[model samples]
Target: MDAFYASVEQLDHPEWRGKPLVVGGNEARGVVAAASYEARKFGIHSAMSSALAAKKCPHLIFARPRFERYKEISLQIRDIFYEYTDLVEPLSLDEAFLDVTENKVGLKSAILIARQIRAKIKEKTGLNASAGVSYNKFLAKTASDLNKPNGQAVILPEEAEAFLEKLPIGKFFGIGKVTAEKMQKLGIHNGKDLKEYSLQFLTKKFGKSGLHYYNIVRGIHLSEVQPHRVRKSLSAENTFEKDLISLQEMEAHFYPIFEEVVRRIEKSGIKGRTVTVKIKFSDFSQQTRSKTLEQYPNADQLWEVGLELLRQEEIPKPVRLLGLGISNLNLTEEQVYFGEQLKIPFHISNGKG
Candidate 1:
């Protein structure tokens, strides 16, 4: 999917096509959920403040998100994926990992399957999708973004090493801003530099994650494409237009967020034993306080824990954002059964895992 939410909006409303569009709340505190390529040319992107987005592109069109419609389209796309392979790992509403190694169509070429999948999606939904075909999930996901709307890229086993060597460390999947900066300080600007570090040295510097970096740079990732990945946590956060200077203001914002998280928990039919309160200061520093109960907490119980965590903050600062989350999740019996049924043996990788 390309610019999923904004693209969907453009598809349904023909007049908005080729114009800079943003899909999200048009409020003072609103954030950009999605932006069209036209909007991107103005330096607008998802997670940016809607106010700032408008400042960047004065004519940026704003539309409220239609998640229900997006979910409907997502299901349609997933159905298309199932026509080829049962091993589909959905990362979000618009992206997924499909292991088509032993597809129902008996396709020997993953690249062909990717092309056909994109073609079918466009045929069914009147939308464009980009795809990447590779031997492992990391390369596949990385390559998927190499091209823009309605394009496809394939990274063969023979080309993997050279392809990775020159790639920027920041562009690698799972590497964040903080981690990339740390790597740069250590003279690791690209895959070639990252590969120079020994596994033991990397582990010593970055803990367990160092091993992942070491192997990934060398084009080795053993993690299987898990289709039935479970949700480990659920959360909801809000960034305020103005920093909250008083405890009263923080409490007022916290309750609505708490309710929203509870609503999602109930809707998902999952509960967690741990409750956490996340606070971000005006300076962008963050802190989280968590407490784990003996059993999964109900909404009321979770709220009590959340309030306690907020009150326990030793040194309060003007807060820019506040969030409530629950973890240590337990799935329902139905979910457990579904997971069991979805579990499958890993497809043998053509490249080093």
Candidate 2:
């Protein structure tokens, strides 16, 4: 599912196809949730400010997000996955890790399974999919992006070492922009550079994450594909067109977001004991406050807690965004939460899938 939300918009509205399109946001405010490849030519991308996106491409067309449609397509794709193997670990609405080692159809080549899956997806949904075939999740996830829109690539186990050596540190799955910069300042620039540091040295420098970095660069990720992973948390947030100036104003905006959270909680039939509120100031600073209770709180109580957190502090500047979420879920720890950005395939897992 390449450029998923934007692609869906293009699919349902034929005239929009092959043209610059975006989902969510407006020229005046909000953020680009997804951008079509045509839009990408102008350097528009997800999380970029809408004002900047419009500045980049004055002709850019913005569509309000239709999450229900995206979820419908995602479920259709997942049904196709279940046909191949029950060992499907969905990383997001558009991408998943499929352990097809002993698939229902008995296909030995993970590459073929990946292709057939992509073909079925295209056939059924009228949208394209890409796949990355490899022995483990890290390389497979990495390889999935090598080709764009309706393409697939593979990485044999033997080639992973050489491939990783040349990979940029910033491209590593678990590492982020700030951490990658920190690594660069330490004279670590790529997988090869990262491999030079000892585990003890890395742990001392990065705490628990040091071990993760040390192993991933060496192609040693041990986490298995968790097919039954539960969602860890659910949250909703919105950026303002204009800065909100008062506590009364903040509470007014806050209720709808909390309503969304409740809507989802009821839809999923999942409950959590924690309520968290997030505030982003106009200056680009952010804060989050959480309250954990003995049981799941009702809407009124959650709203009360949300308002309490919003008023607990006096702001130095007006707010640009408001958010609310819940955690301490009843589900087990084996879980993967949906992300703003994510991917992958695999008839392969590190083990027998």
Candidate 3:
């Protein structure tokens, strides 16, 4: 699923193929959900501000995401995957980790299974799919992207070390812009360079992720293809268009996100004990203010506690990003009483000076 949302749009609308298409809101505050390869040529990317994307590519054709259609297609793909193995762990609508160790089809080769699955996906959905076959999840995930838009790539266990040795560090999972910069600073420009450092050294520098880097360098990643991992939390955070110095401004901005989170909580039927407010300064320093309530909460009460936390924070600098998260979920009978209290109209504690 290369450029998944944009690719879906292109598949459904043939005329948009080979052209710059952006799937997201085309308004002032909207962000790019996906960008077609053509759009990527112009430096447009997903999660970028749609307004900024348009500025980058004046001819960008923007379309709002059709999540229902994507979901339907995803289900169809999952069904196809079940023909091979039940050990399918979906990473997203377009990508998954499949454990073909003991496949139902008794296919001697995972590469052949990958190819057959890709073909079936194209035939059933009238769209292209890329497949990757390897000895493990890390290599398989990397192999999948080697070829895109109806492509397949394979990595044998014997070739794993060589494959990683030549690979760039940036291509590794969990090595984003920040980590890449730090790696480069440490003379770790690629897999070969990364392998030079001892595991202890990496772990000391990067904590838990350093161990992952060490294993990946040796082509020894042991992470399993877990099926349908239960979601522990659902939250959204946003960086403001402009920085805020005052609590009043923060409160006004938090209002909508708070309401939206509550709506989401109700819809998902998730009860959380802890509500956290994340704040980032213009200098990029970050801090969190949180509260653990006596009972589980719905949207209204969640926001009330969230605002309370925001009021207690000292504004040492202009705030750049504001985020809200609910965790330590209460998925039991106690949740019902908490919901009732939240729904009951009452005065909210502003927690502001």
Best by TM-score: 2
- Relative to the unseen true structure, what is the C-alpha lDDT of residue 284 in candidate 3, on a scale of 0 to 100? 66
Q: Would you list the C-alpha lDDT of every candidate in the order shown?
A: 0.84, 0.84, 0.79
- Candidate 1 is scored at a TM of 0.88
The residue ranges of model 3 lying beyond 4 angstroms of the native Cα positions read 25-29, 236-256, 278-288, 298-300, 314-323, 331-353
Question: Better model by TM-score, 1 or 3?
Answer: 1
Query: What tens-digit string does per-residue lDDT give for candidate 3 at 262-331?
Result: 7777777787888998888876688988888888886668878888899884778998678788888855
Query: Model 1: per-residue lDDT, tens digit, 198-261?
Result: 9999999999999899988877888887888666778888777678898888999889888888
User: 269, model 3: CA deviation in Å?
Assistant: 2.8
Count: clashes, candidate 2? 0
Where does model 1 exceed 4 Å of error?
A: 25-28, 240-243, 332-353
lDDT of 1 at 200: 95
lDDT of 2 by residue, 63-113 (tens): 877777898899999999999999889877888898888899998999999
TM-score of each: 0.88, 0.91, 0.82
Deviation (Å) of 217 in candidate 1:
1.6
Q: Cα deviation of 303 in candidate 3 (Å)?
A: 2.7
